[model samples]
Target: MNIYRYEENPIITPADIQPYHKGFQVIGAFNAGVAEYNGETLLLLRVAEQPISDDPNKVLAPVYNTGTGKIDLVELDRKDERYDFSDPRVVRDVTQNATFAYLTSISYVRIARSKDGHRFTIDNEPFIYPSNEQEIFGVEDPRVTQIGEDYYIYFSVVSPKGIGESMVSTRDFSNVTHHGMIFSPDNKDVLIFPEKIGGKYYALHRPTMKSIGTPEIWIAESDNLLYWGNHKHLLGLRQGMWDSGRIGGGAVPIKTDKGWLELYHGATMEHRYCMGAVLLDLEHPEKVIARSAAPVLEPEADYEKKGFFGDVVFSCGVVVDGDIVRMYYGVADTSMACAELSLQEILDSLVYE
Candidate 1:
């Protein structure tokens, strides 16, 4: 795969963003949703921020208090036998077998604008934040689809209840109307088709199943965007492959003369994430036509190889202009980057199974 990475690969980083709170630091500014709006490229960045803690033996977790509309800080002692701090991202309580974040960070969506696709300027304030109980944990990994004059935003909402998919739509970026949770708990990585197929709305989602199922991509049709059904399995993990561990949908499916081009992310058991492409039947997107045997984009550069989480290249959206596909992706789960691939090149790289 020929991936022309931007000269300034990491176009947006934590340092480029302003912390949401006074005593917190922005840890990640990646996994953004891309769209062309009002003659400018718009990036809906997922900004992750954690409370600043100077104490070596103590960890501070930031929790959003829905009642007070403020973030509450909780201190956890490292020596506490009840909790396990083995993972840098989360703390597991041994007694209850419940996992929680160590340096608890809240993720919110922020906007970055650019006249050209390369250089971007991040907004001072967040575009969307945790406002209700469902998103108390945070709103994350947004995928935006423009249908007619409105742009629909689909993202994961995390809380104590469980992680689910939520939707909201906006015409002018300033004000958005929340559409509530569309998919229930234990589901995420969702993207809606820009137009209905076969006289019904369609979506691609991943529902994490504990038994008799693996984390794979699935497609469903809906009469209305709010309720979806007629679920059909789309793609699964390929054993002994780079995507052997898990797979999920990435950018909103791009329509092409060949098929519905979908850029997706797959990971190895080692948790190294990479981007690949799949072509779905236009009339029946549930049917896969062809998939890439190898990754189109992977962690190669220092920026992609090292960060909050290492060896990762994940995308949420892309912008296609004529023959060029501008893919905006998260590098090492830390910062945002862009790469260009010829639409014909990506289609040529696909191998039918």
Candidate 2:
């Protein structure tokens, strides 16, 4: 497939916001989903923030608590047998034989306006912030889809209990009505189809599973938007492949005559991420007609090759105009970027052969 990256790469990087609390500092604010609403571009960013450790030379950290609305500090003696902080997945306890849970980190949506989808001007403040008790940590990875007269925003709500998918609706962009959480515990990366199918709402979700099932894309149906059920697995990682690690929906599904085309991100066993495609049957979305045998986009740019996490090209949203699909993705976990490919070309690249 032919991929064209915007000259202005790394569209949005983490900018230091005014501190939420006295002692905490939020950084590494990057990776956003894209949408077009009211002749403006919308970004749903997964802004990562961490607090300053009490000891400047030490690694001991404090986790934030939403229930009591306080920050809980946890001292981890690396040399002690009770703490094991070696694993990249999470910090573990070798002596205690348990995981060392940290305080919750959070994210919020910051609106950026772009006339040409390349150069953007970010707003001074966040569009949405964590207010409710359930959103103790923060909201993350927002996907915006315009349906009918309302703009529907799907995001991941993180808390101490588990990470869940939530939805919010907006008509004027200034005010939003929180519809609460849609999926159950241990689910995220939700992308709603741009239009309704068979008179019901369809969404793509990654149900986080520890064993038996890896992180794969799944589809669910809802009659009233709040409750989701009738889930069917959509795509999974192939053994010894580029996407052998995991896969999840990237942009909201693009509707075309061929099928419902979805651009998704996949990773390898080593956690290197790339982009791919999946085509579902128009009427029966549960039926996957075709998928990408090879990656449509990889970490080719230097910006994508190095950052907070290297060798990654993760897309949260895209814009489709006629035959071209312009995608805004996070490069190397640090900054935002843009790329373009034809809709026909992406569909043709799918492995239906």
Candidate 3:
């Protein structure tokens, strides 16, 4: 798989962004949603911030206090046996059975503008932060779909209630209208189609399973974009292959003559993430036609293999100009990077079903 990585990779990083408030520090600036507004390339970045704490005896977390409408820090004693520090992202309290009990960092969607697609200027404030109880944990991995005059945005909402997907729409990016949670708990990686098909809207989502099945891409159709139904399992993991563990929708699926080209991320049993391509029927996106055997883009660079979550190449969006596919992706869950691939090359690499 030939990929032309930007010479100045990691166009945005934690060090490049300032903390939203004083006691906090930016730890990650990645998993951005790509779009074009006013002839400028736009990236809706997921900026993660963690509280400053040097004490070895204490672990600090960020929580959105719904009552006060502000994020407050929650500190726990490291000596406490009940605090499960297994996942670096969350300080899970084994005593409680509920998720989103405590998160190590809180993320918000911020804008980063670029003229040349590689060089970006990070914005000061968050474009979309945790505004409701459902977003108490944080808003993350946003996917934007432009239809007519409106840009419809949907993202993952993490909270004590459960991890779900929510929707928001904007035209100028200055103002937004929140449409509340579209998909319920334990479901995320939702991507709405750029346009409707067969007089209805389409979407791709991932529903994580606990006992019944594995996480795979699923297709859903809606009449008004809010009320969604007719969900069908679209893509499943290929056992013993690159995407054997789990898979999720990445980037808004690009429309091509070949099919609805979807660049998705898949992880191994070891949690190593890589990017691959799949082709779906344009008229019937639920019917996938082709997919990659090996990853088109994987964690190979030193920067991609080391940081917050190492060996990961996850993306939320891409920009397709003519035959060139410019992919804006997150590396190691720490920084934003860009790479270019041939549209024909990616399509040719796929195995037709």
Worst 10 residues of 3 by lDDT: 92-101
1-353 in candidate 1: lDDT tens per residue?
Answer: 67799999899999998897999999999999988899999999999998889998988877778999888888999899998887777777788755554336889999999999899988888898888998878889999999999999989998877789999999988899999999998899999998988999999999988668899999989998999999999999999998999999999999999999999999999999999999999998988999999999989999999999999999999999999999999998799999999999999999986
lDDT of 3 by residue, 1-353 (tens): 67899989888989999999678988899999988999899999999998889897888888888899898888899788777887888877677753436888999999999888978888899999998899988999898899998999899999887899999999999999989999998999999989988899999999989779999999999999999999999999998998999999998989899889999999999999999999999899999899999999999998999999999999999998888999999999999999999999999999999
Which rank order by TM-score, best down to worst?
A: 3, 1, 2
Best-to-worst ranking by lDDT: 3, 1, 2
**Where in model 1 is the C-alpha error above 4 Å?**
101-103
Using Cα atoms with residue i matched to residue i, what is each candidate's TM-score against the true structure? 0.97, 0.90, 0.98
Error of 1 at 219 (Å): 0.7
Clashing pairs for predicted structure model 3, backbone only: none
lDDT of 2 by residue, 1-353 (tens): 78888876776666534545456565555668676767777676666656666664334454546566565555555566565656422455555556445432446777777777776777666676665655666777788888888888878776657788888898877899989889877898898887779999899999999657789989999887788889998887899988998888888888889889998999998989999999999998888999999899999899899887799998888888998898888888777888999999998889882
lDDT of each: 0.91, 0.77, 0.91
Root-mean-square deviation of each candidate, in angstroms?
1.2, 2.6, 1.2
